[model samples]
Target: MGPGAGEVSWRHWICDARDGRLICPIDIPSFSWDMGIGDFGFSTTDKGAGKIDESGLTLPWAAIPASTPDERSAMLDSQRRAIVTTWAASDDPEDKGTPLFWGKITGRDDTWLDTSFGLESPMAILSSRYAVRDGAFKDGHSSDSIAFTGMSYRGICSELGRIATDGKQGGELPFDWTYTGERGSHDRTDYQAWNVQNLAVDQLLTNIANCQGGPDIAFRPYWADEQHIRVRFLAGSDADVYLDMDHSPVCLSSFPDGGSLEDIHVSYQDGYHRWYATGAGTDQGTLTCYVESMAPITQSMDPPVLREAVYGDTDTDNLDLLRRHVGGVAQNNSGKLMQITGSIDFGDTDQFGVPLHPLGSMWPGESVTLSIAGFPTLPDGDYGLRLMEMSGDQGSKADLKFDVLEAPFQ
Candidate 1:
């Protein structure tokens, strides 16, 4: 009932080749009843309510094929996070302010086995392991509370804020607080007017969304005076990576130019690293804050951000120009680099994208792979590899356009 997972423990169902399981794990989010489209943010209805998984942008959702046994071992040994197939409570939707927890639902999105590789002898059996956990937060911080989870949309954070504002300490609910759903504005319209302590709900909402964009954007409280948090975008193919995080040069001075995860300390407690409140309001004891990660959606994730300069010739006629650009920004973070394992988007309608391999053709579904080792997939023509970087919502996202410059879609 306390805030935790792992200790409560559960069994990791071993996938069997004999039983025959085949699907791209990268496409789980598109089929996830809780995080995917159909179910939206609400829990499942039918006990076994299910949807065929469609390959979508890869963000390490539970949908990807469960990690290979070796990959699982390495993940636990390396990353502090563990892998598991999380789940949501399968009941009570119309309860209005009901809180739900996520468990047995780890992974990026879908958990399936890649059958095409035929790595496991075309019949090799691969499975993932699971260790039981206690004090799992999924069961709710307490029997009466729920764990922090992706709530679905960026614009509807008020649903979650409503709960934190009037938490069940037996106090009055926030029906009295002015509510508005304007884009980018904090959930409560009266956010600035609230007592200091009450600002927690508002600050938390912003912080959660900030976290999804990585360390580039700080999710701290906004004060009425002084400078506000400024944002910068580093463009990439299919996704946008943010660079500026309202950090001062003094703080950047301490950051190592190059180091492992262990060498960096971005201050998880401070506004940039972790979460914090803003605007020292006098009476309400300075609005406090607590934030969860941004809500899960089928949005494309920016991979490693890339930055580069360009030199080119322009056709000023009709602006029908052709140019040669050397390097652009990474799709994920802003580190000096030429290449990285990243993801971007074409558009909401163009979801088919995957890690480019050698000699492969286009396919149906949101997930795809282009293999070009010894064969041709793209049509013969001049194709432009244009990278984009956009900033908004105090963060940014991007897309990589691979189109024929002088031809039609083949």
Candidate 2:
């Protein structure tokens, strides 16, 4: 029989994180993945929580053994990993299925008939390792300082990833690592310099990527073969501009001519009106910038409430760059930012009848332009989809949460 419409098939595989060797396959009856770039749709806090996908799964007790050393190692407690692949019901299983997630097993719960495991994206795994110090204690001088002199953002992340994986940096990691995409120009002088001390690999990477005008970074997985699953580093400021997805510029309009979005809810936060930023140097020599909002929201405050913030960058000494950095930060957080949450029904189509594949079409850090009727506060323009919380089981619609892209006062 042909597969029914809206039917989706899922497959799970437990693999050795070190070498990507297939450890075992299990039938996961149900699972949900919540993946995104930042904390859930909040504009004020640090958005450096880079692509930390989280999920939980339950498996039959017989699927993975407890006594076998290899199987036990493959279990969540041993820091092994799992990959989830899915496809349309009609697609042949012999073909390579789309890899939805690849994460390390972090926690576990066991019962007589079933066991549940917690899975987190690669950033969570990297967080466990710290950025290696520049020189060992045995090497005469020991320093926690790591320097990036005029290096592109992509190069910085690549170096940090290498430091985390290569034993020479600290200890060799089992899994392979590689990065792709470019951020700044190849001109050495064009890139900025940065120095960090005693930071975790994940923290260092996020701090760099979340800076003013930084590119988006994601840990993406690709199916290699039965024995290997490949994960690649993707970083780019204009990543989506290269895609040719026909459904893009997808409109979620309530107007008669367009398709409608369901369960639309909007909330706003009181963002800071004044920003004070310090970079490099100490005492009176520090480079600093201070700016206050002149936006509509700030002006509307009856008594003109003053919300202030202080920011620090450890490596930049250029005063102009520091000003630009604080300027961008102030612009993003100066007004009341809107946080929108909604869902698109499975098998739904856009106004032009293009099938809406929420997960397939849009990703975190990509841009989406839409218009809603009731919320005239949000102008019809470009908005960034910074965080996506996708949760569903089997054949179900995925819930989506989009954090504010820009200040609404604009």
RMSD for each of the candidates: 24.5, 7.0
Best by TM-score: 2
True lDDT of residue 274, candidate 1: 20
Worst 10 residues of 1 by lDDT: 117-126
Q: Residue by residue across 296-370, what tens digits does model 2's lDDT show?
A: 544565543568899887555677666766776777787667787776654564576545653445555445555
Per-residue C-alpha lDDT of model 1 across residues 32-140, encoded as one tens digit per residue: 2221110112111222444323321123323334457666433222112211122211123221111111111222332443221101111010012111112222432
TM-score of 2: 0.72
Residue 188 error, candidate 1, Å: 11
- Can you tell me which runs of candidate 2 are displaced by over 4 Å? 1-6, 38-60, 65-77, 85-91, 109-114, 133-141, 167-197, 238-260, 277-289, 294-304, 312-327, 349-355, 374-389, 405-410
Local distance difference test, each candidate: 0.21, 0.56
Point to the candidate with the largest lDDT: 2
